[model samples]
Target: MILIAKIVSIDCNLKCDYCFYHRWNQNSNRLMSCGTLETLIKEGCDYSPICAQFIWHGGEPLLAGLKFFEKIIEFQNKYRKNGQNIVNKIQTNGTLINEEWAKFFHSNQFGVGISLDGPKNLHNTFRKYPDSDGSFDATWQGIQILRQNGIIPGIIAVINSANVIFPQEMFEFFIDSELKNLVFNPAMIKDDISGLPTGIVAKPTDYGNFINRIFDLWLKKDDPKIEIRQIKSVVHALIGGKYRSCRFKSECQKYPTIECNGDIFSCDGDEQNKNIRFGNIRQGLNHIFSSEIYKEYRRKIQRLRISCLDCQWYKICRGGCTRDYCSRSQELPKNYFCEGMKEVYQHISDSLKYYKILPL
Candidate 1:
């Protein structure tokens, strides 16, 4: 079981236009308390069967300061059970990463991922500081520092209007920067009250085309080391393996996201949705996971719609993310990105068949 900990809450330095977190009131600068952190690590370590994976998510996790992470390492080592592997990963904007930070990540063996949309112009279009200054230069410099420290950080670029139009360029940007590990998240911002996707979200067709371009570029490459998370997941699914992404899982399960105040939500995508909350760490992981509320929530999310069940790619795409559904109904949900998902999956499947990875 992986824990997605929003350690610093929604207190980010950069104001990206399409960020879903922007819908919530982020005036409060709440940091996860020491007591909460200790309990989380202890309980999380106890609960995880083999590996206790902690994904340090943000509103800029680095905003919590380096000392907070040092304490996290201490707590993990203290509470780690015999033969239980502890893994830590952080996703950051990369503006704050200096030589010291890079060295620390490398020394600790932390899996680092940076949020960069693309090259300077495309990245700067939507990702900017409060003063409206573009963040590409600082972020790029941070990437350089990490590389100098012998850490090739993963690039997590958001697919929006700015970068989506230039898929080949975006792919080249990463290759040029020597950032082989990549994850492209489509810009999908949902309306708070209505639960309908709105505002600067990439159109289904646009996203599908963008992904196709990247896939073509990827296939032409001589390097097998270049790993794109979405593409890898698709390829894995085509090879008769389960979709590695949470969004495309055959049955959606609880990969809980812990808020700064210790409240545990069902998924990172639906953190703001109050209905999926599985109580706090103070209640203990056993109590939270075993509670009737959590079970009911899980059941509700796992129910596949008739359309999804009838689809040929049910095993590959499942129903996609429930949160990305155009309608909020739990009984009969339809993903906003269904067309795009199908297009990409089909593209990958055909490619695999051509390469003789799949039987004709």
Candidate 2:
């Protein structure tokens, strides 16, 4: 299981228009206390059956400072069980990365994911600073620093309408920048605190075409150095590989996100809703596991929609993210991107046949 620690709360330096935290109005000055981190690590390690991955997320995890991670590494070593290993990963905006941060990450063998949309124009369209200044240059510089430190950072680009139209360009940019592992998150439209639709949500078909174009570009590469998680995940599962992506998982709520103050949420996307709060570290993992909310989430996952069950790509998609289904209706329904998912899957299967990457 994965435990996402929102250590720095909703304290980000850049204001990305499509950020879920921003739309939810999750502004906070809270930083995770050492005691909370200690308790969380101990509880997680003790309860995990095999291994636990702690994904440090935030407004921006680096905002918590280097000393915080130093102590976290120490605590991880101190509490880890003999057979159960603990892995740390951080998903950062890449603006705060420097030589010191890169060195520490490289030395610890930490998995790093950097957020970059594409080239300057596409990226800066949404990702901006407090003064409405573009952050593409700063972010790219951070990526370079990590590379110089001998760490290959994974790229996560959020797909909006503006960038979706330029999938080839995006793929080329990542290749040129030496980014290997990539993940594209389709921008979701959700009601903000004021009940207005927030961010530039990509049309379902546009997202499908965008990924298809990227797959075309990905297939044409002689080296095929880049690995897009969105495509690779489905391909891996279709070929009977054991994978753990929430998008293709039977239960999306298996991974719990713990807030800075120890408030546990079912999923990171569901953090804005107080109703999804199960139990905190103070209450113990057992208490959270036994809660009705958690049970209901599991139950919902098991009870797949008839439409989803009947769909050909059900196994690979698994009805997509549960949060996407329940965002507005307050109920777990069929995935909103059902058609788009089908299109992408069909495209992938066809490409695999043409390239002979998998058995037809």
Candidate 3:
């Protein structure tokens, strides 16, 4: 479905090592009241087509409790002014997951995604509770419940520099587990410029290199159930097929993200970036287009940097997610990530000289 609405909740229990949100410090938001939800849905029904989705996202959505989510689903069930149909889904860290949440998911037809990195070490390296206790045991305990209940859990792993070299290990670890689907999102860091040091910036080529390594592993598998968002998007375009996407997929459309505190942004990538806020969720996403703050955000998306426009990778990367490229400024590029992509592409192309899986 194209028109999807995300119910955003801020404030998470876990504090990971490579947490960009913490680096940005945008997590001090509260619960979204029912009245705000009603107004937003009513406005969306006026603008969008019939097929719409209600995706619950958060610092930790389950932290809002199951009863709050139940109320949300109930609102979706009745919140129709025109032909808008809402399909409920949730992407959650499997901490508070229990039989109760699993049952609610099954009955509501919600697609469940769990945040799980590889084995305990790789996961604990970044993802852990605020108290610094490891979360693997509790997370897996919930996963086991979902498995027993016949609810398929989609896996989401954020790659840091350490695990970037081990695509085979990442895959084998997931394959050995019950996970049949996985999404790989590289770690995103911000420029610090805080006390004495600047933030750690992630280069585009480094991200590209990481993607290429995963592509290599994917080649080895006969029929991959793993669903990589970036490669799958490219493959969908190459094969002349269709694919599902959030607001981030297309350059033309700006997806709206509503925070629990009543702030709204163009998309999820702009979640913490201070420059993207446009009006309150009490108004509508339509306000984003009209608001002056969002105009620059849209402007940055439309006007490609001079160097990027001429680059060979532009067509494939589309400047590597507008929010990512412009998270710092409209002018500068993450030369590191871009160069890493080139290096990774060459490595893969060279490897293909000896081993060809997809017809070259």
Task: Provide the clash count, candidate 2.
Answer: 0
Better of 1 and 2 by TM-score: 1
Candidate 1 lDDT trough over 10 residues, lowest sum: 268-277
Error of 3 at 291 (Å): 4.0
Model 3, range 1-360, lDDT digits (tens) per residue? 223334445567677766656544535656677787676656555555575666678777887777777787666667655666666667777988999988988888888989887888777767888788888888888898998888988888877765666667887888778576878766665555421112333345555666787777776675566677656655554344576343124352356676666677666654234446677866666765677777766675656444666876554445554444433444354333556655654555556555653356
The weakest ten consecutive residues by lDDT in model 2 span 190-199
Error of 1 at 101 (Å): 1.5
Model 1 TM-score, all chains together: 0.94
Q: Is candidate 1 or candidate 3 better by TM-score?
A: 1
* Tens-place lDDT digits, model 2, residues 1-360: 788999988889888887766654444657899999999998888888478788999889999999999999899889888887778899999999999999999999899999999999999999998688989999989998998999989888989978998988999888987887999988765664533334487777888899888888887885666778887787787777776467777666778889899988877764233367787889999888988988987775567555577788888887786655533445445566677878999988887777777787
Residue 309 lDDT (model 1):
80
Report the C-alpha lDDT of model 1 over 1-360, residue by residue, as the tens digit.
788899988889887787767666655677999999999999989888589899998899988888999999999989998988889999999999998889889989999989999989999998988788999999999988998999998888988866778998999989987889998888777776886666577888788889888999999995899999888888887786744877667444457889999998878775334457789999999998899988887777666345788888888877877666666756555777889888998888898889998987
Q: After superposing candidate 2, which stretches have Cα over 4 Å from the reference? A: 23-28, 193-199, 271-274, 302-306, 326-332, 355-360
- What range of 10 consecutive residues in model 3 has the weakest lDDT sum? 193-202
Local lDDT at 325 for model 3? 45
Q: Model 1, stretches more than 4 Å misplaced?
A: 25-27, 192-195, 250-252, 271-275, 304-306, 328-332
Ranked candidates (lDDT, high to low): 1, 2, 3
Judged by TM-score, which candidate is best? 1
Candidate with the larger lDDT of 1 and 2 = 1
